[model samples]
Target: MITTAMRTRASIVPLLLALGCPQDGGTASEGGPGTSDGTSAGTDTTVPTTSAGTSSSGPDDPTGDTGDTGDTGEPPGEPSGNDLDQNALFTCRDQPALPPADLRLLDRYEWTRNVGSWLSSDLANNPLYPRPEHRYSTYSDDEALDPSVLGLYLDSVGGAADSWTIGKWDGGRLRTVHEDPECQCFLYDAAPTSECVRYFVRRYLEFGALFRPASEAQFDALLAFTEGVLAGAPDVESRPAVIKRLGAAAWMSTGALHRPELGAGEPDEHGRLQLGDWELANAIAYALTRTPAGVPSVNRSYNAGFSKGDVDGDLGSILDAARDGTIKDPEVVAKLVEEHIGGIDEARLDLLFEPHDERYWETHSEYWMAHGVREFFREWLDYGELAAQTPKVEVAATSAWSGYAVENSYQNQIVGFYGYESTLDYQLDDMIARILDTDQDVFANLLTSRMFYTPATAGYQENETSIWKSTAEANRVYNVSGITPQTREGRWIELPQNERAGVLTHPAWLGAHALSFENDPNLVHRGKWIREELLCQNVPDLPITVDAKLSEASKSQSARQRMSEQIDADPYCAGCHALMNPLGYPFEIYNHAGFVRVEDHGGPPDGTSNLVGMPSPELDGPVTSAIDFSQRLANSRYAKRCFMRQTFRYFAGREETMHDACTMVAIEKAYDDSGGSFTEMLIALFNSDSFQTRVPD
Candidate 1:
């Protein structure tokens, strides 16, 4: 029976045909001679000619003979046959148990951001973007692009082609950095001839794939596929329009979609696979910034002079460094990091928060975080979830007036009686920004720093003061004592030391870790976060037969009192809960809404818990409250090492094997040497063998 799926597959047959791949025993009308596996027979994708006197096919290949050349008077540069790697490009190739090369697919965010930067349009809301299914990081190298996902990719690119116009093409893109006359036709509005198409396709591969030279086979297949597209297009469409469509097709190819961390050439004597110039450039840029090396962005505004003018967003200098091999130096990499890693100036930060300007691609939320430094903390701390799924917050009038001195009458009335969980994401972001600008003890500061941005102080840089004030007042749960609507000077303020410590103690983090839509603390989840993320310890999953539900909350007992009876009483539950509950119970000083609780149910809340079996003996005993816990965690070497590991996982897009131990040790030393500067650790990490080299299977 004919199905919708069948019809969808049938519709794109022509475009696939244009790719010059044919099924086994396929007819010539399908685009080319068919191999048994439906792949091209050779490695060259350039169209070949039947000229008998043709001496050689270029430097990579020295064979004087051309294959099965028919005297069609075609161009002499084309290779013998359609030579694309069908398995790698068209299907999910079987990965080796330990693959020789490290190839990570560009996550949906990276793809959307890159495409948006290239096109200079906002594509963040594009429905075609496939979000990462993982619970933590947005990217995962372990995931593969299967057949179903490939179909989505094909549809996405095809849709992009349909919507694209000639005017949208950025003609000036990569032109200054790439001065090759033959390759200048990339997204050009002018009509390119048959001969110019090959050069155009090659350039597309090079730029789209982040300067990695396309293989001869890939070049030949793409060239023929592009020609087929042009020849077969309806006369209703203009040549430039057709070329744009073809450009979209090439943009979504395997070479463009997946980033190659395979490094250059073969393994060395020590079995190290050092990244090539282009590969290294791409790795550095992606690790620090969301975009590739040569893309125009404020992050790449380095002082290195290039023939192309050194504009704010111009990254031509980086491309030049890669080409000249200066980027291979560790000092150069460190310099680039130092130059790019910084906070936005007040003027620009104000502008970013202002109404959107059509001239810029960056948004208020994204502009200030160009280097993704803030984002790293956001994910690592996992606090952003509060904004996504806010839990209910209710603050009484007496508490609001006495605790935060609710001065605003409207706020007092609204907040004193009732409140909802206001998203404190912006507040946390601002706090991180302030600390990063200081650029000292990044990890330590994140854990134990009392300085923060309340709504009253949010507007000076990010222009979020008034909004934050209203929200905080409405929530009536402002735990910080000095912050009020009237204190709107827009400066960072320190909370009372006894009340708060670090990001974990922040209201946002507390609210995010709370049980969904409840005023109750999520004991297991909070404990698990500490166990896995901070301590680098793993908790066993609950057995299938176990009913993990806790007894209902009541006015008779406190949260800790109620939870302990169920979790600690059971032998099996206690076995795992012992690792997590003690770590989590310290946070009970604050309610689910992040309000400092004077009383829970009927009595003073017990926030005390014992930390046992910790890798660091100093951190093994203890714990009075969240503040005390934060102080201990801030000083723990074990915690810092775990943070470094998390950082490695985040940037490398995968879990570290034993091979990464040296890198970890080096990063630790660098962190200590720089007095715990996160930036210095990153520099050390980027230059480390684990980051720069790969292992061959």
Candidate 2:
């Protein structure tokens, strides 16, 4: 837990700013210190100059040799491939241990992606105008998994192996099957029937025996076997042919095999299809394993010449008969339908369906519909279970704060309920409202008293009247009558003992500041601002390890002088500051007013500045574009971890402490397990013991 003294000290300046009552006689517009050069004073030293002549090798250039080890200091040898020491691929040990809950969370993220892909495959080539593209829009059944529907979809799209191709097809032709190179063996001539059986079997084995819920050794063995099979050369002429032959041969039997003969298909009065027992068995097995050649089996009709309505009516009747016991066994009903339905020609099926009409069929009866149903059922089940097992943590309704406001005169869209005259004023008002609405007594009290209006102490001007009014409202509402006049001195200041406790409230304004100043290139800056203001984390002073030689030699200094110097000077400071500074520097464009300013103190107004001394020297240049900054921020290690931690806190609804290492570890692990989704982390946190249980104070 953070110390009270630190919280008090941090709360004073912000509280005064929040009160709309400034001690300084000057108006808010006449704010102190609009901009600082951000340079440190140091003694000058003579440095050698280098010519601007082009060279094959430059100080910042990467060595082109494959054998070049660079400065990583890693051993120059092939990594061991053994499971105990699998150094070739990135192992979990190489990185910090993520929470186990994070793994489950990541799985949820991947599951969503998988479901999205499934939905896309179902909706591709759909005829419906403005067809739903996302999974939420299509194929949700809200029930148990409809294996039959899923199987039909898999058959039409050629299973997961052909998901990419399936995704390319429009909804108009969902039933229209295409011969995919990936699954050519399952649809082509000279493709043995046994090969189709083996292909499905292999898929099942891979999914069930090799993936999660299976042991690592089992996974390794399966992978090894697959690799061996792929590496081996067979007698087939082409790679596809080899794959087909291997698939076929794996399931073929050399001895005498029992074959079933097809009978003239007509049902008796009892509605049972006139099929031999052996024939029925064969058809059942085929339905389970055989890949459809052209159209999906669901849309295929045994009686193709019949009217469209009649064909649909017949299917409905058949299904109804099976349900009502008029057809007795489902297997019998299935057999009768198969015989009556004319088998679609694999090659000609695509030609029969109009591309424009296919979307309706998919929407009405496809995997997307089924998936939606499944999701609904899962949610229902989970909700019931949660209600029964866990006590709900009640959070009061809070004001929504709109961070930064872009002055879009054309759009008059209002977000938060707090109505201020201007966008900036509205944002500040919204922040004050959120602080007032906090459910925690300590947090609420702190925000209301010493920490409410202190934007200026943290280097922001609180000249806006709308901001001041909201702060006064919060103070009155929370009944903090005795807040000392001395506490309202600066934009940021420490709170007195009678004012407040807890670190969350002191950082609330900082959090608002960070959000208000957010821009793509300024992500690092936002992060640094958050760290300094909210968490009160100490950021070390800048060092001087930059390319002094280059800067001293050239009349025009290199763009990365400030960043490079700090990184190169002290190795101890290099790691943390390097991580923090670049992330913060990107947000240099946001000034004290919480408005986007394209210029730094001495640079161009377009916020195209760059940081030097990064892991890659090639990236050391002026970041003149938002894309460059966004990519750097998104890919930063600290940004990723901080995001994870914030998500954890939001869902867990509590401060993390050293004693909660196991929970933290579990949460981080879960994030890694899941594919890093905010939603997944939420679910994992909700399902965690820390979230479910109430700890005694």
Candidate 3:
């Protein structure tokens, strides 16, 4: 069940699914699957409440009033700067963003589907008739349950099952379903034609279906299981009957076991009671009579008796009892589920339906302690007494830190580094704690400046020529400029210190260089990043126009060249690319690998690469190292402002406008005054209004 691909694509599937698929209703609607109606399911009859407040607006609420706490600031009025609208930046609306309860329901549905698929597949050669899809509503009935859909559902369920298996199942094979005509309808024979098939089908029905349903008595039994499991109780005699009933149903459903006649004297080695055919025939009848709560109590009693004196057996029996009933108590089933399941829903699901994952708690705690940089700014903006509470502040600080860690550890690793494994634990922790514990004003001041990127060669090799390498060595020099030799021993050393001042002064241009190398099939992304991040320009999309020739002409050229030619062909493209293409052109010297290269298998160093056919300034730069490139970039005023804009956007999670000129000026001044220390810029942005207030659209 465990596969190598699962480990790598764990995050990818969910993200892609969230983005690609519409919500449960199959339209661009809010409140999709996994989102709760806010109140407890048992207490309130009202519709589920989402964190996204009461807005009946369609999913693409340009105003961004979808009720989520996070702000997606889209400035008002016609777009002006660089001809790009501020509204174009938000992408959060394109995803599922489900709540906890709904997520659990989705998990349950997927799990059931997975078990069903496995059963169907295993019995494919069997003569049993295939069941038709349940027709509940016209819409539901119309949606065909195709193999692909079933496969996706199965995959999700399998993931959850795998997660459960992690600490509990111990490599037990999943139960498989088969057909047998001799067994009564829904009666399973304990001794089947195939042991593997019998065991799998029995386990699947018990765990995947009967036990997961929500009913009154099942809920009670779930609570009981939770209490017993947490206490490590050895006796589970209270829930055995439920387990037996569950096993019986599963056995019957698969036709692997016949309904047994019950006149049981004692249980067998596997804790199953010996029964006559008549007893097995009456199993479902007995099960139907008991309410959900009644089953758990019966199961508990059966488990206690079955385990007798063995602690491990007692625990296993208790779990089996819980699994047999309709109790959804995660705590009782935590060990079982964890041992049997396979997915990332461990913590998120636990938060909704069970106890939270201990690993998540630990990771979250560490994350909070590591990233407190923005908290100080929030406090300074609020000017509240709560700011004095460093511990709480530190906790609040972890959100950003954890976000960065995940972004760096997962997203950046996959996209930016092309799956390179980067060590983030130590750096994230140290940076977060230090940022939080430091004086608020230090950070406040740091944000007021436009210094966001910290240049450090900390992880780079000594001989590396990347900007990170130079910055690391330079940071040490900046830290110990005039300090005594003895005192400086413990301090960080800086190299190329003067040359590498702030993000702009460092080899921040490497990002553009990196983009250039990708030769991305889509030039828009490459051009946009170059325009927005390098030249401080924003290229908003033009109105839909049927330009067949443009598309046709682009087929023959590389993305970069096509874009260059397009800019020349259109006045619209020309105006923007004039500010974008030149800045991005210098980066062409570096390949997608971010390595220096002389030729790109095309002619080299054409001086006539005009932006708008005006014979633009030549970007015939030599490729030696990222540091040399960084120094060359440092001369451009556009680079400086671009860094400032990027820092503001990153801190605010939105774009900057002319209205933010005051904050930008202050930040620029701070950066100039602080010798371009990265910390200075961060402080400046954090203290600004852009960081403090949630702007209205």
Candidate 4:
């Protein structure tokens, strides 16, 4: 009697279990964290109790202040971050079913970024590099680790560690540890004093590797491991080799490899578990900085002359607060969030178009916003896929029709060295960065902004040059029309509002969501993205018995006409197509190449479509074109809430449920309070219960 959805859910549990994460009552076994080597750390296995004087009182008496805790009572403490007064403004009618705590594995993008920044190596490009889980959102945790991935992690950790070197900037150049008085012990001393080893372990292992205050047992184990490496060496020359091996083991340890969110103490009276100080620190760090601590070396060209805020000092404050448990204050967290995201310069947007090469980090030390923020837009819009997969073949220029030449000419437009698809990707990224830089009405602007980034807006970076000698010479005819020469010098041109609306009408997005090589439109998938992603609604998968193929193309009829005759008329397919096709048909104004179509298959293309039976009654209406539809979507309150829902999924690393009602409501309020600023929404999310609290299995 199990339904298909139930069976699918059941299948994922085995996949999670196979990954070696413990699922027994939401606790880590003896083999967890400190004892990855199977050597018992001899630390207390029992959950730690709250240091604060709060006891397991009545359901609403956990904090003795019902207003502070909202519907789900607060954990034992002097009000953790989630207990802010604003949380009580709206209440959760449903029971709190916060996501259970587990070890969140870093995604593939993070691993690659870490390998480059921390190890200073391109080893992530190797075929041997471990492949993590694949998911739409960058923040989704990997549930299973393949055997091959484990083996690769074991084999590659040592070499990756060896490639890294601790250095300082001196006179605008990098100085090795050999020249540093304190760091020199690591390079030359074979039989270093105990004091030397402790400093090394604290500096590299605690902050650099484990990303938290190492447990006493962990510290002793690593200290012993470091001494053993030095003592077992054959010569004084071997001292240098010891550091890499020591670093490798630290990097390989589970404490460094996975982020543990199991709350330090027992579950509260409401079964709500609270994250420990160190765990919360890391949670905020990953949410904001995408690292355990700041690594200025991530930007290889960092000089002492740079005017950005003190990286070490800023991270030191966060760590100090974690150790003192002052990070539990929502006010403290809100201030930290402001410091991280506020006052971002628009110039940083140039980095988005920069290829993520070694030079990319050299020229730009910090991103415009958090890397996670940038990734959310890329993943949400699904435009990042265009750069990786540009399977659309260039249409051949033929004398048969002038429109064919227009579609074919785009491939020849030189925008640096990128392919036509990649150019579009970069262009869309540019538009997104501009919107984000404003930090006002972000979701609405993203949907309705007429400003567009063309090739002329490529900025003054050394590797980038404006490819357009003239508007006619550029690829604007079919690719992106109405771009002016004034778009140069980092200026974005306002495209005709009638021709374009938001990013959905952008050539890159339109083309990315279109058919491979055919001149016909890709209806279902485009509609599917809009239906599920924007509306936060689900459409069931097509049954395996259904062939799902569209009717063959005909020069006599428009693509929409053919689809209407076949898909709309068929009762079996009409059910789902009704949900999607109406949403997609409006986009038929643009062809597969993303060119505005005047004629389709010798006839005028029908771009009229309507939304019916949607979650928002405001959105369910007739539309003349994609532009009008996009404007409607931008203005709809339901669509804006859906954007917040999507943002929660990216940050929380899971889908939002009824259990997360309180968090979602708070986030929406924060968005409204800040005039729809993404920065404020992130602050509200970081302070939400679902982010700071856990649920024990």
Candidate whose lDDT is highest: 4
Models ranked on lDDT: 4, 1, 3, 2
Candidate 3, run of 10 with poorest lDDT: 97-106
Tens-digit lDDT track for model 4 on 1-697?
Answer: 9642243233222222112211221232222121222222223121111111111124555432322221123333423222222223235675564665555555544554444332224445323222233334433233323454554454455543432453343221112222236555665565667777676655555434555555555556667666766777846576545666666656555455566676756677667678877678768867665654432223334443332223232245565556567778888887777666534443453242234433322322122556656667777887766645555554321112244323333543323233222256656766776777788999989988988766432332233434322222234433344333332333356777667788888877877787664344477668888987787667788899998665464434666877788779999989988878888888887766566666666667667887778776889889999888888899988778778877877777665556677777889888999998887888888888888887643
| Model 4 worst lDDT window (10 residues) | 46-55
Q: Candidates' lDDT values, in order?
A: 0.53, 0.27, 0.29, 0.56
- Taking the tens digit of each residue's C-alpha lDDT, what string does model 2 give over 198-264? 4432332222111101122222233343334444532223334333222222111100010111121
Q: List the residue pairs that clash in candidate 1.
A: 43-217, 45-220, 45-221, 46-78, 46-79, 46-220, 47-78, 447-502
TM-score of each: 0.72, 0.23, 0.33, 0.76
Q: Is candidate 2 or candidate 3 better by TM-score?
A: 3
- Model 1: lowest-lDDT 10 consecutive positions: 25-34
- Worst 10-residue lDDT window for candidate 2 reads 251-260
User: How do the residues 1-697 of candidate 3 rate in per-residue lDDT, one tens digit apiece?
Assistant: 9553243244223222111111111111111111111111121011111212212235576442344322222223534234443223211233211111010111122222222222222222222111223111100101222334433333332232331121112221222211113222112333223333333333333233332222222223333332333234223342222232223222221011111111233443433332211121122112211111111111111222211112111123333332343222324323332222112221222111112223222222111220122222222121112212221111111111223222222223122232112112222222333333342333232212222222233344335434332222222212222322211122222334323322222122222223322343223433455455445554655547734234554554444576666665687656655555544454443333222333434544221232332111222345233333344445544455555665564434334555555666767776678765444555555444444322121
Judge candidate 1 against the unseen true structure and give its global Cα lDDT, from 0 to 1.
0.53
Tell me the spans in candidate 1 whose CA falls farther than 4 Å from its real position.
Answer: 1-100, 117-141, 159-203, 208-211, 215-240, 296-315, 347-371, 390-423, 456-476, 480-491, 517-521, 553-556
> Residues 1-697, candidate 1, lDDT per residue (tens digit)?
9643343344434433233211111111111100111122222211112111212135555442334222111223422111211112112233211112444556655665454232333333333332345433534333445555655655555433322232322332332223345544544535566666665565454444324444445556567766765666635346555655555655544445556555555576666567766667777777776556654222111222111222212345555556567777989888877766666543233222112332221211222444456557778788755545642544332133332323332233222222222126656766676666666887889889887655432221225443443344432344544324322133345777877887887766776787642234366678889988887767887799987665554424556876677668878778888888888899887776566777766567567888877767879787889889988998887777778877876666555544355566778788889887877888887887766765532
Query: Which of candidates 2 and 3 reaches a greater lDDT?
Result: 3
User: Which parts of model 4 are misplaced by more than 4 Å?
Assistant: 1-91, 115-121, 126-142, 166-181, 188-191, 234-240, 299-317, 346-367, 395-422, 457-491, 551-557
